[model samples]
Target: MLDYDREAARYDATRGGDARAEAAAEAVEELLPRQARVVVDVACGTGIVTARLRRPGRRVAGIDRSAGMARMAAARLPGGVVCGDAAARLPLLDGSADAVTMIWLLHLLDQADSAAVLAQAARALRPGGRLLTTVDKNHAAYHTGGDVAALLGPVRDAHTPPQSDALDRVLGVGSGLGLTMSGRTTFAGLGQGRSPRSWREVIPKSPWGRRMDAATLAELGSRLGDLPDQDHPRPDPVYTLIALVKQD
Candidate 1:
């Protein structure tokens, strides 16, 4: 993944800013309990969405591996932001939170790391507590057209996260740890859709692109160059959030 510490500065701007943050928080909330007392958002980059998730009864805290990202989150949430690795053990105690969330996180990891993060999320939740996270992230990048989606085939399947039939496996991972899928929700990616040319520039920085062979990347670039609307944004995707509950 791109250096999150380096990316922290431009994260919100490149992402959909507050408007997108609000939309994401709302979607996550829809999958959360109506009255959760403690909610910890793992990999809460910059705490933008975490801040918006604060509700009357909810006490929100953010944890991230990027010190730079955590600094920004700390400013927004004070001491509520803990600079820590989500793939390893968090400083949190077991069964400490009513809800644990890892939004837009899992797809960024390899299969092993994604499982570790999910394990951590499950460890941080109380029995019967909910764990909400985003999955099928790359799929969102192409809610626009078959052409764009076809070109990004490799990137689209670069994850072990929930999306389409893959969701069954994701739930299986959670179920093995006593976390079962209970519900889900979706939100507009707003301002996140991209055209082929622009997406070509993004390939190298993406998780899949980082590991892609030079020949394949070159071919992808060639294909992208052939597409129309070189600079225009495509249709914004509907991002999905899956909610799982920890069994007692």
Candidate 2:
């Protein structure tokens, strides 16, 4: 995956800012249990959106692997955020939280690591607690309704970065851990459309894109350059949110 520590400085500015965070927070909160007393957001980079998860009578915590990201998170969440590897174990006590979130995390990990994170998330929850995760992050451009979107299909499919089958893999991991798929919803990625250069920059930042051969990148870049709105952004994309519950 991209080096989060290095990217922490500019992370918020490029990530659609507060508008996107609000949309994500709303979707996450809606999926939470009404009685949820404590919630944790895993891989909560920058804690921009994680901060918005806070609600009256509910405590919010953030976890990340990057110290830089955690530093920013601590500013937003105070002493509530921890910098550590969740795949190994979270700093929180077992079954301490009513909800554990891995928003935009699974798609970045491979099968084994993804399973590790899922198990950890499930372990941190009380019986009947929920785990929320977002799948298919990079393919956001594919779902937009605009000319730029129409041109992105070929490029997105060719450079596929963990969008398709992400949910199935998550469900498989959850079920193996005795967690069940509880619910799902969609949220708009507000102000997230990107110009060609912005979208291209995103490629090298992803795990898959970093490994892609130079020839493939060149071909995709050429195809993208031919599309309209080379500098102007396309329509904003939407994200799918899922909720998995650890049964009591």
Let me know the TM-score candidate 1 reaches against the reference structure: 0.87
Global lDDT of each candidate = 0.84, 0.82
Off by over 4 Å in 1: 154-166, 204-220
Across 1-248, the per-residue lDDT of candidate 2 in tens digits comes to 78888999998887778888888999998899999989899999999999998889999999999999999999999998889998899888899999988777877777778888888888888999999989776566576876666765665676664543277777877898879988998888787778877767776665556667889877767777777667897778889898988988
Each model's backbone clash number = 0, 0
> Candidate 1 residues 1-248, lDDT tens each?
78998999999998999989999999888888887899999999999999988888679999999999999999999879998888888778999999998888887777788888888889889999999988777667755566787667655465323432246657878988999999988888788888777888988777567777888778878888998888877778788888999999
Per-residue lDDT value at 51 in model 1: 90
